[model samples]
Every structure is written in structure tokens, then in C-alpha cells.
Target: MADDIVFDLLHSEIINYALEQTKTTNGSKEVDLSVVEYIGFAAGYKIMERLTREWPRFKDELDTMKFICTDFWTCIYKKQIDNLRTNHQGVYVLQDNAFRFLTNFSNGHQYLEYAPRYVAYTCGLIRGGLANLCINSIVTAEVQSMPSCKFHIHVQRT
Candidate 1:
């Protein structure tokens, strides 16, 4: 029911924001890569909303989050972004857009001028909205960091 509540909202907002972002910066860029990534973030943010509603204890652990991310990946992203629209015999289409949106966000963002910091900031944005309604605290850890980057995400108590 909640999925029905949020899917179209997430879908439209992400596409609209992606289009606005592309127009503001890349100047008429298509929704090839970056838009997909942005959509992933927005969709992930939404999915986290409904998901935690079912699994109440899912929070504040690196490995648990990784597992959730993995499921989210396989069920949503891997077939599309990792496989990139191949007609590979074994893959199935994701039932929704979560994969296209987040996978792109994770990968495409790596090329930004300040990739690590931007991601931390991104985590903040995602958390700012969902922390109270669904989540308690966000725990994000960058896979890599630079001396210039002061970003780190760790567990926070509710």
C-alpha cells in the first residue's frame, strides 16, 4: 500500500529533478547516466521508507545495511546498470526503478570533482528527510576517501 503511495511520487520527482539538473549544468543532456543515478538515490530514499515499515530493526550497522543494499541491488539495480540492457539469458527485469536510480548515483558520482564529500553531503540530504519518519540515524561510510575529504558515515543512536 505504501509502495503504491510513494512510487509515482518518487518516479516523477526524480525524473523532474534529473531533467532540471541536466539542463542547469550539462545543457540538454539526456537521462543516460546521471539521471539514472539521481533517480536511484531518490528511489532508494523512498524504498527505505516503506521497507523499514516492515522490518523495524534494520538500522545502524554496516553489514546489515550492506545486505539490504545487496538485496536492493539484485532486485532493483544489477540487471539494468551492471548488465546495461544486455539480453543476457539469466537476468530478469526489476519490478521497479530503485536499481536504475541508486546504482547510477553510486557509480556516476565517482567522477565528480569532489566525489567523496559530495556523497557525504548527499547522505545528509537523504537522511535529513527520512530520519524521523522512517529511519533513526544514517550510517554511511565512504569506500574511499582523500585528504581533502572529511566525510564519514557511522552509526547513530535513535
Candidate 2:
């Protein structure tokens, strides 16, 4: 349905545009971040459009921002991966039970060394892009023990 349209638009249309952007910068061979960052920005831009459309008169107040970030991590992203957590801070645990149910999905064969850094990069992609839309935030990740993935994210309202 709607997902089909978005998939076509992103893959068929937006993907070509992203490729052209890479070529203009000369193949992204010397600079790896070029390609990844391009995809990140494009995806981020599209997401922002959807966010604005869904919430017309967006007010980036503290409580409102908290709700949006929590909803994004817990509901949208968590569904795609098993055992995702959106817990922030200590004691209060402001958001005890978060993330509504959705289709379960798993990450692909993630590399051994990069599993944690990869997660951190994703967090930055989402957080940094959102900041472009006047939503100030920060993201960090950590994977301590090998094979066992552990990711931590710290987000603040601004």
C-alpha cells in the first residue's frame, strides 16, 4: 500500500539522486563517509517530511520532544530489532513501559568489531538529522562484551 509507494520512490527515484551526488564528489572512494552520509541525510530528510505532515503545527517543547523521540526509538525502530530499549536516566525511569507492539525483525550478520560503533552511527544519523529540524539532541552507543551486543543511547530535550 503506502509502503510500496515509499519503497519505489526511495529505491527507484531517490537512490539515483543519491548516486549522482556521490559522483559529483568524485566516486566517494577516497572518502567513505561521503556515500554513507549522503544516504543518511536523504533518509533523514524524508523522515522529517513525514514527521511534519503527521504533526502539522509542530511545537518542539520539552515534553513534546520527549514523546517524539521515545515513540521513534521504542515503537518504530524497536519493532525492527529484538530487545531494544529506550530507557533513559536512573531512579524515576520516566518511561517505564515504552514501545508499542509491531512486527519483529532482526539485524543482519553484523560484523564482530563494528557492531557497537555501527549502532552508534545509526543513533547519530537519526539524532543529528532530527537536530536539523530544530530538535536538539545527542546519541551515544556502547557494546561491551564481544558477541553479546549492548547499546546505550542518551537523548536530551532542547
Candidate 3:
């Protein structure tokens, strides 16, 4: 319990530091979270390598997504995805009723404007994790309410 709180605090601080660094460097009104996302991407790619070291090779794309929805999400967020939807056409949506990052904020839409900054890293994390698995994807997030968030994964077939 205490460890979780510490982790959350550290995560929040990292995001805040990244935002501060971006503001200082760019000196512009636009908030570019690409740096944060890229950091997440790199972290995800490396973490995935370690996480899957002892696991068997995935049989298909669906299997890989399952790993993300279950093991990967759980490993990082400490909870399994609440819902996962797919269109059989290379699109997958993973919903979390209580996203770890957002859960610390209000449950209402008070902080809606800042949700993007919070989710950017996670979006990159998902993308990076998939990339490490040899699956090219564009990961995006939709936050309707504060704590609940949905991540959309578009698998690129090339």
C-alpha cells in the first residue's frame, strides 16, 4: 500500500518535471508531450524485453494484445484492463475503469483539460511495448471521465 503511494508520487513528479523541462526549453504556449511519450516508448521497449524474456513466443497479434491487456498492464498498472474490444480489422480498444494515473485526480471532469498530458506517456508505452514485440501500432487514449480511460491501439500491417 505504501509502496503504491510512493510509486504514484514518483510517477507524478516525473511527469511534472518533464512538463517543466519542456516549458523552459520551448518557451512557447504549446505543450509538447512528445518528449514524455518518447521516454515512455523507450521505457516500454526496454521493459517489454525484460518482461518477456522467459515467456514463450506469441502465436499471433491477438495473443500479443492479450499479453498487453493482461500481463503487461497488470505489471505496470497493477490491474488488468477492465474491457478489451477489437474490430478484427486491426483495431483494439482497452478500457480501464480506474486508470492509475488519473485515479489520483478528481472523478469528475474538472481536470479534463489536462488529461492529455497525463495519458501521453501511457500511449507511448503501449506503442513501444507493441513495437518491441514486432507489432507496429499507433496507440491513443480517450478520457471521457477523470479516472476512467480508454486506449485505442491501431495495428499497422506492413
Error of 1 at 130 (Å): 7.6
Query: TM-score of predicted model 1?
Result: 0.32
Candidate 2 local lDDT, 2-116, one digit each (tens): 7544643443344345446666778654322344444654566466656556654655344444544555444334422334444334111122121121011123333444343
- The candidate with the higher lDDT, 1 or 2, is 2
Candidate 2 global lDDT: 0.43
TM-scores vs. true structure, each candidate: 0.32, 0.42, 0.95
Clashing pairs in 1: 37-104, 37-105, 39-101, 40-101, 40-102, 77-99, 140-153
Best by TM-score: 3
lDDT of model number 1 = 0.40
Give the true-structure RMSD of model 3: 1.2
Backbone collision count in every prediction? 7, 0, 0
Off by over 4 Å in 2: 1-34, 56-61, 74-112, 136-138, 145-158
What is the lDDT, from 0 to 100, of the residue 21 in candidate 2? 64
Which 10 successive residues of model 2 have the least lDDT summed? 96-105
What residue pairs clash in candidate 2, if any at all?
none
lDDT of 1 by residue, 21-109 (tens): 77788676443334444444565666665555655464534434343434543443243212222123322221222333233345543
